[model samples]
Target chain A: MTSPIAGGVDCDLHPAVPHLTSLLPYMNDYWRDQVTTRGMTDLISQSYPVNSPISSRPDWRPVKGKPGSDIADLQRQALDRFGTAYGICNPLYGVQMVFSEDMANAFCRALNDWLAKEWLDKDERLRGSIVIPVQSIEKAVAEIERCAADKRFVQVLMLVMGDMPLGKRHYWPIYAAAERFGLPIGIHAGSAYHNPPTSVGWGSYHIEDYVAQAQAFQTQLTSLIVEGVFARHPNLKMVMLESGFTWLPPFLWRLHKFWRGVRMETPWVDRAPLEIVRSNIRFSLQPVDAPPESDTLNRLFDHMQSDELILFSTDYPHWQFDGDEVLPKGLSPDLVRKIMIDNPHATYPRLTVKEMTP
Target chain B: MNVQLRERPQAASSTGIKSAIADCDIHPARATKDELHPYLAKRWHGHIETFGVHAYQGMMEGPPYPKAQPNASRRDAYPPEGGPQGSSLSFMQKQHLDPNNVALGVLNPLNTGQGIRNQDLAAAICAAINDWQIEKWTSKDARLKGSVVVANEDGVSAAAEIRKRAGDKNFVQVLLLSRNVEPLGQRRYWPIYEAAQEAGLPIGVHAFGFGGNPITASGWPSYYIEEMVGHSQCQQTALASLVLEGVFERFPKLKMVMVEAGFGWAPSLAWRLDKVFSKLHGEVPHLKRKPSEYIRDHIWWTTQPMEDPESRDHLFQVIEWIGWDKLLFATDYPHWDYDEPSRVLPAGVSDANRQAFYLDNAKQLYGIS
Candidate 1:
């Protein structure tokens, strides 16, 4: 059933990178010259090919450029349409795609700046995700430090699929920065393409690649849990953007089951996997990946054991749900409130900016 | 038989429902140490001593994340005779097979060299494992049946092994690990599927096989829990590869029983595959039917590492979506996360569904009279 109410917070809305030229203004002199000299084209991701149905809803697509590129369209279709009190702009630009560490850092800086200038700065209601070069922890931490000053930048963003599992100690510096800055780590669906999209091998179709993304998130989530990411950085929250929520309950159950038998390996995991997930993980509600029956979806909610786990999202311009029915059918009124507003506020403490006295 | 069926023996099941049932996923280690070495040619032994088994990873000790328990087996399962937990027949019967009333138990022998990169060595070890299964365990135990363990990466050798074991009453299916060199559906692995179909034996892809790559697509995880949960994730990829790449269409009669991987993910994975296939059917035009249809027509799943969702009904919903007949009951005996058949299924299951889940499905799938 569609939510009868408004005033929700859309946690995951993509503001597309129009083309390489748009990022030039944000890039430094050396990178700008390199881009012009190399004559690079747009860096749209393969996971969300521009023409694919999954990339953007039919009406939400911008006629001139990429979907979510035009701020006016996103405002009309997403914010105003849903009466979103606050919306987080998770830029799905290819900032983490470059092989060179310096190039990745440059692109990430440009992406964050572009999100701030083009999206966040334009709308008081919209917030930005700080895209970081995940390959280099030093650069990633530096980027987090640079962007945390904006307060408008609420979360540090990285791809679900990257060079290694996000839980490894190598990536802990980024998480440490996020925890220190009171910014959650927003892990969005998409990959750095360093490895095959799947553990077995590369699949033939885009659908295979897209569907396989959930598996990537599962692996990464497990890595985070087993690797003691949460145990070490206890205060941090990791938001799964566009990585569906319905799968979380079972995924946690599986981990909890195995963790019992293998608890000795990671002694830092002092609590149950379920408890850790409750304490740290939050999923943005979109692409529900659920059966249509309200009762069935409701049963899944029951299995999840908490209403506060999901923050609301239209996954705007991503063709997740048509029209406004961004909220799935089964949520009760109280549950909707938790998902739409309370959950987001609780997950991203930085969502509410305080006034400076100076 | 009817009177005995009506009786409720406490030891027969952890829950109340008690009757002799078929267990689809029992792992039986060798009866004695070095039992398989006799089956292997002497030259391989010298090669093994000189170079050792080249594991997929750098470590020779085994998985990077060690199990909480020794060999990831039940502490009580170790035999008094000083072998591994599953390495003794009488001990297994005493602990699990007899007490649980496991009428017909299928043996899944893991930790073979099927996952090694050296194809010739993998094939030799696989052949030795096949011989060891018969001469050691299945030959002595009438209730036990063997799986034709194959070098999953070397399809040609695997198929040849399957053909060699064709119509052997002791052997019921061919075994492959969920994690392989590539998705099992690729043409490289088609030969094994074809041979299994020709032999009229189901191919059982059990979770936790020979590990080749970092179990996760991105890389190795921090803990063994990631590897454990990764079993289902890898199987999803295997099922998708099999359906999308026309494994089912090409080998129409081939039957696949996904053992040890939890069954909860089947409905959702198939649904996701169907949704994507509808939009991107052109990419895989070779598919003769929807991915879900192929899944319904071909695949069978075993219930091990049974999902304990917050609500029992969620598992019921998954089963209802997958179908009543599609699930084969398994007790991952001697393993750390073993599911007791009596206690695993949620309470209030109908007798007919229980019959299908515990006994009828596996009996029919394996062609057991």
Candidate 2:
């Protein structure tokens, strides 16, 4: 187990689209005309600003185009480079930014279709997540049902910060639908900006905004656990993609401590908060925010205890790590194998190939 | 300006939990608004009686979370004399100060007038709360000390209030809430810091205030647990704003004490802050030092709702990163989650760390003897 797993499953890889026009061919005539007439050039990216240093690694950024625009480039960099056997492509094209429920629904449909046609259809190793317009639960559930037919669409994608807490009852339908289809609910790190990233009003810098995303992840975790999202949808898999994993240990410790003190208020949360998290929630391991020291990473892991909670991810095109050192400094060989291979297989029920009947 | 060193707690008897020490964060609320009438001006008596106080929360009268007992306090803390919990000094002495052997208990009066909408009324109430602390609690007991409560929104008046109490040895710090109209680092609240620095008082930012925003960034949390855990997030944001916005660089002498906001996240937050600051250094050129350096130098943290990691080693690791010297002992007296000094830490912690944590550091910070 000391050797790195070559055919590791990459749970999160972004397939970038340069502009809204790229999806126009996939959209119906009514929505296409509406978008073009409105001069909606490109949907504003809520998470990654185009020119921000965090958007894409310098070497990975295209010499003359979008970072992940080319299928050949993604294959070369993410799959071939990392020896990834199966890579789940998550296209963050700002389709979820559309305000109107109808427009948002149309964009989500177009994005899913575009992903199926362009990336998933082109590569056998590539899997995709259905980007849903989380603004309207009805439309979000409808899109989930529509995409459930495609086995390649293995997960439901939504932003971490949105119109409301994902755990709220209004959004539980999305979770229920995903559970029915065996699609893991993948919450990406981004915000709708309906509110400030911090509890205080808007921050002054991008650094503040970027650092505050960790807190958003923490809040949403509590929301999901306390709101009984896990209890109702027992089999649901909630994957927080591009959300750093190091913060989870301390966050869970504090959550579980408080739960012990105030469990009566949330009777549905019968188990300890940490237990609920280990059993239901999984976090992507890229953008590891732990200190570079091996000891610190080991200490964090000791607190976490469970091997299945972290899923391997390259977070392709994003500049989280400098080189091939996507894994933190000091994870044990067995834990690495679990994170890179077995964990992702367990998290995404559709990722594994079934044995042929003799 | 001679600094006085308090007598060391008769050398850690057995478990190394000091019996006699300064309790940095002890909330002493008024039993009723009528108790504060003597401290308030005649002009605002009618205003208080008529309009009452309006806090920047979802509800008009109570806090957002109803699970917190009526006063948002411990039921056991309610005085036998029929007043609210923590309102009676005699009961506090018997229940907390006497049994706990608190040498100096700092009064952090909340819910009196800290988050009110009316600036004049808010300032008046804050002043009255401070006076009420001295009259009913601190002045009566020689071991009790008051924290000058200020209406943070009105910096001018808040500063004036600080100046008035500057010479009083009984008041050791200026009390402000983490949830304020703006981040404490912003210029809008600088006057309070300036006065605090001038008065040689540290600013103790306690959890729970009405900063005109929900406890969470998205909205109000559904349960008491979310609200409780969210306290650290608010404190993190405040501390980040204070350090990154160059508040510490401007007022070099100003010290901050993060009360009831656990320190487990401090080391992690500092690491993240330094990581972000190195890249965005130009945005805040005035910050002469690293974010962690300012935090280590200017800020002190109180251990009340102390973080409980799965292994005792994890707790020690957090303490190591935060530096034992930076910690000040506190028991959010009368609060349901109050940490007893003897039992707070895991068994393996050394006597030296325990002594510094419980007594020495806080005594030095407050110049208490």
Q: For residues B1-369, what per-residue lDDT tens digits would candidate 2 score against the true structure?
A: 011155434333324263676788888877765888899899888986787778877576666777545565676678888878888888888777876778878888777678788888988888888888888887799888889988888889999999999989879999999888776677888899899999999999998888787666666667778888888888888888888788898899999999998888887788777866765676678888989999999989998888888788888887888899999989888777777766887788778887788888988898887
- Per-residue CA lDDT of model 1 for B23-142, tens digit only, reads 998888765546778999988988887888885667676566676667778877789898888998888887788778888899998878777878899899988988888887888888
The digit string of per-residue lDDT tens for model 1 on A123-163 reads 88998889998888899899999989988888989899888
The weakest ten consecutive residues by lDDT in model 1 chain B span B1-10
Candidate 2, residue B13: Cα displacement in angstroms equals: 15
User: How well does candidate 2 score on lDDT at residue B42?
Assistant: 92
Task: Evaluate all candidate structures by whole-model CA lDDT and list the values in order.
Answer: 0.83, 0.82
Per-residue accuracy of model 2 over A36-135 as CA lDDT, tens digit each: 9989888757467776767778888888777888889999988988889889988888777667889989888998988888888888888889999888
Candidate 2 positional error at A197, Å:
1.6
Cα error, residue A123 of model 2, in Å, equals 2.1
lDDT of 1 at A203: 69
Q: Which 10-residue span in candidate 2 chain B carries the lowest summed lDDT?
A: B1-10
Clashes of each: 1, 0
Give all TM-scores, in the order shown.
0.93, 0.94
Best by lDDT: 1
Best by DockQ: 1
- What TM-score, to 2 decimals, does candidate 2 have? 0.94
B40, model 2: CA deviation in Å?
A: 1.3
Clashing pairs in 2: none
